[model samples]
Target: MTQKKPTSRRQFLGQTAAIASASLVPFGALSSRVSAQSPNERPRFALIGVGGNGTRTAPVGQQFADLVALCDVDAKHLAHGNGLLCDGKADLYGDYREVLAQDDIDIVQISAPDHWHTKILIEAMLAGKDAYCEKPLTLTIDEGKLIRKVQKQTGRVVQVGTQQRSSMNFFNKALAVIADGRLGKLYKITVGIDAGGWSPEISVADVPEGLDWDRWLGPTPVMPFRYLQDPKKDTDRNYTNGHTHFRWWYEHSGGKLTDWGAHHIDIAMLGIAAAGQNNDPVSVGGSSRHDVEFKDGVPMQDNRYNTAREFDLIVDFADRDVQINIRHDVDNGILFEGERGRIFVNRGKLVGKPIEDVATKPLPKDAIAKVYRDMPIMGNDRDAHWANFTHSIKHRTLPISDVHSHMKMLNVCHLAGISCRLDRTIHWDQTTEQITGDELAASMMSRPYREGYEIEM
Candidate 1:
């Protein structure tokens, strides 16, 4: 590793002036002070899971780091992602472990399925690499704990792919207004996620030619391949889309609860945190209706999707004053209802009288910067998340979406899924971090991994 030179007096004064102007929080406790690297010394990056989301994030990684390797369970996906790189020059691999085995890669991007996230993230950190993992960071509540433990042990930089954290318009602006007390007293938060449980009826068929199905199903139970052909092109044998369709299954994902819940729930928790409320919910209860019948939490029909089609969940915080209601029927977004006024935010827009009032009654000058943990507000720029991750790796600082807060938010999503699955109210002991009373509900917190794929501490 190259050692960075000492900062000049002029550079220190400039940094001091920037911090003073932004009204930024002191970074002494939030992150470590490591030597910053030069632009010419860009880190080497290896990307795993070149499916839809993976393909999208690859170019972003290219913008900050050298694209050294691309890995995917499907050969066609790997080839496609590699082609998107600068002159298609990076090496390609069918297995992610092979990419991690290399000593030169400094950053690993895990954009795989929800089930594979924890395993890859842990292995990447253990291999001495910083990571940028997509959200719904873990498949279960237990996985989140394990990832945090490993991250602490390794001291590696990890940025969860909850891009909203870096967005200036929706999340940043919303938090700024809330923190400024524009919305007098936040009483309730409503999050609406997309409805799930649509799986076309299909028969068992052979795995496609270019895909390594077993590897793709890493950590998931071994099951027969269910053929899913594109409705538009009936004869298309390529099951690329089908391979990534695991999100609809409970075994692989928590449906829309974790899918969109990861994003909305995160912002909800951030709002709660900004308002000086405990981020973790103490009690969660919900009811769900699935397209297929579930027996002992497993769907009866394996041929079609099993996750809930419609559901409503109510969450109570330790603060007692704040309550969260999650539903499937409403449009996909978050609504924060407070004593003074309410605001609604999603990927597209952030609106409400409170937000509108900011024109005449602007936030307390540095409120936006404060919401971003003292960083400058980069409005509507999607690349800010990637930039933050890379900047953290270079400076050894905590990015906006650090692992600890991400896990806390994910816990709420997982609890909601478990409650909806059992159709009962579940009590949670936040101090102990366990589900109370119902042993069956408690068991859902973590899952038994397949023999070779279990997450080892």
Candidate 2:
């Protein structure tokens, strides 16, 4: 890891500087069509960005839909996905646009990097395909706006890949206590998403064979491909910039802010909303520690991972008298604290007196069900999310993890990034979804799209 030790653990400062889609058609000008799929009818699916997540979720999507196409910018990735989902039988392509052109594909399941999700999803919706995108959905706050707008206009059933929403009885059970007011007016949600890793420096190299480097850049600025030899091994096969570690780079991702923050902060908002509390934050401010020095929120180094390795932010939803403290020093998961009691929940278990009391003093029969948004508990984890997506497609209903709700939670994450990058608190207007009075912070909202790859509408 190429990281320098932090000079001070407690530092408060103020400085600011900061900060996809596709389409042949404008969403406003296009006529949308959505046919209700029969309960048993298998919706055809296209798996884009067939890397680790694409391979994982794409096969799961097959449980509810047929894999009609697999797309990736790299040929090896496409082949890897082909090996996983189909026995080299499904049609494969290097460009996602080609997958959207296939009229038979009904659902485009995206497991792409955060940077590519918006562009692929907007294009898929415009091409008349429902989508299931990976969590943390957007690379920036404005991307969320674009996605929500296009989704509303196209009437597409877009499900974000936030599986924790249905992780067995863990979150649902924990959230039920809050919704039932058993926590006695919860005041804070502390989400500990661990921390980001300081990456070893990577060296620039020529693009590898079978990769459409230009197309892969898509809306991102074109940059030289970078690769690093695995320190523990003697191979340069793993690219620090592309297939595996893009999340660590700020240009391609929001770092850990949007990575794990996408998952934890989401559940925090769900608990807030389920408890009938306002979920939008009024202001966001915090301190963060990064290996690379930042100038006006921009990282100084380009060859190594630059995201925050440690951070603590306060997302104050003043209207509800609640605050979310997102930090790296605590255990990974969410903690709900209030006057009466507190409970902790993660993939492992839901703990605390509230959870234990549920055995003797059981919550209402519909308590956890309500947390499930009244949707019947499907399977578990990713399977449950996929099931819900298919059910919503058939029933013309919203999946549990809808884009609007996801973006709502994601806003907190992006704001945290703003505060971390700038080293100061930024006020937020929940209604307009704007960072008020900070030109540098506001500039972080949307990024420049490369020419010939700009998003339409």
Candidate 3:
């Protein structure tokens, strides 16, 4: 649990750089890589889902690991990554399974859609590859459970890209306020994640050339490609409902709930822990706005964005006497109100009476460290998040955004999404991590994968 803070960005990079240049060291006798590789050799990584974020991640990943392969179902995206991220030399594939098949790949970085995250990550670990995956690590509550099981079985190191926890000093500082008792008995958390983008009527369109529409819809049901032509260029992908536009559909993602929720909501749970409390909610219920009508959480129409465009969810922790309201109208930050005082934080700034009082009333020196569970803030968010992952790969320890904590918070987000879909309050038996009372609601916790793509849990 103890980690030394890197003195400088240069020093951190130098240490990470050693992973690639250093001589091979024993990863373990049990590793499949025993003959061909070691734990110390620069991990050869396969980047999956090369979209906008994947392109941005490539350069950062290369600073610590080698990018030897890339995969994306859309040929256009694959080409973009090939030219820009890999300079056309990394072996490219349309199927991620193929990339995982390569013997040389020791690591995987997944930026795939939320629906695909669990399957890919579980397989990567079972295949003996450690990985780093983007946030909202699971599409459903069951998915998170399945992933936790696999992680424990495989003993693979994985990190979730919930950057706010790493990059935003303000966020951790806000958690410190509670840990330091600047906030007297914490009572409520108001999270303003805002709303998802709205889309107009989408028309069925021919699948774009070089894109495998089938594979892109991997685990979701087969549906026609739908899109709205660019208003200006007549070539945009804005409302396509796949590729760049999948987040708008409940079939692919939880919209802003998981999109931004994975970031802020995850921090909110840590804030719960900072208050010396557990985060299991006894009841989750809320109202949400969908562009289309719904019957039992299933959208009645297909042409419009179906995920909640706007929502307000209430998560109650009855045992702890705490409540969290995830709303669209709150300022786009977490407003933590306690009996003593209040402080608000997002990626930008941390403020309020508690923060102001900090000038004179310094927080407990170990407050932030306690919330982060002892990992020293390395450098910038980018430096620390990545550094923590690479450091874990070398030390064979869990990274900062380890699967366990990430999934625990993510389950709350998934539960909220289910509540939005069903339009009713659902009780949770936190002891079993199961939905209680409503069978229909309980069923929504996990979806049956389209036949061929089923995950082996």
**How do all models score by TM-score?**
0.89, 0.90, 0.89
**Alpha-carbon runs more than 4 Å astray in model 3:** 1-40, 230-237
Model 1 segments more than 4 A misplaced? 1-37, 230-242, 376-381
Scored by CA lDDT, what does every candidate get?
A: 0.80, 0.80, 0.80
Which RMSD values do the candidates have, in order? 8.8, 9.9, 8.5
lDDT of 1 at 339: 87
* Cα lDDT tens digits for candidate 3, 155-269: 6788898877776478878888888888877789999999887888989999989989888888889999986776866555367887767888889998888898888888787
Provide the clashing-pair count of each candidate structure.
0, 2, 1
Give the per-residue lDDT digits (tens) of candidate 1, residues 1-457: 1112334545544543443343233332223222245556777888888888987877877787887788888888877777776457777777676676665677889989899999889877666668999998999998888888767766678999999898886788899899988887789999998787576676788887898888878898888878766677757543322566677888789888899899998899899888767766799987788888777666788778777888888999988899999999997889999889999999899999999998998788788789888854443455888888876766677788999889888898889888878888989988888999999999999888898776533
- Can you list the residue pairs that collide in candidate 1? none
Task: Quote the lDDT for 448 in model 2.
Answer: 86
lDDT of 1: 0.80
Candidate 1's clash total is 0
The best candidate in terms of TM-score? 2
lDDT, residue 342, candidate 1: 96
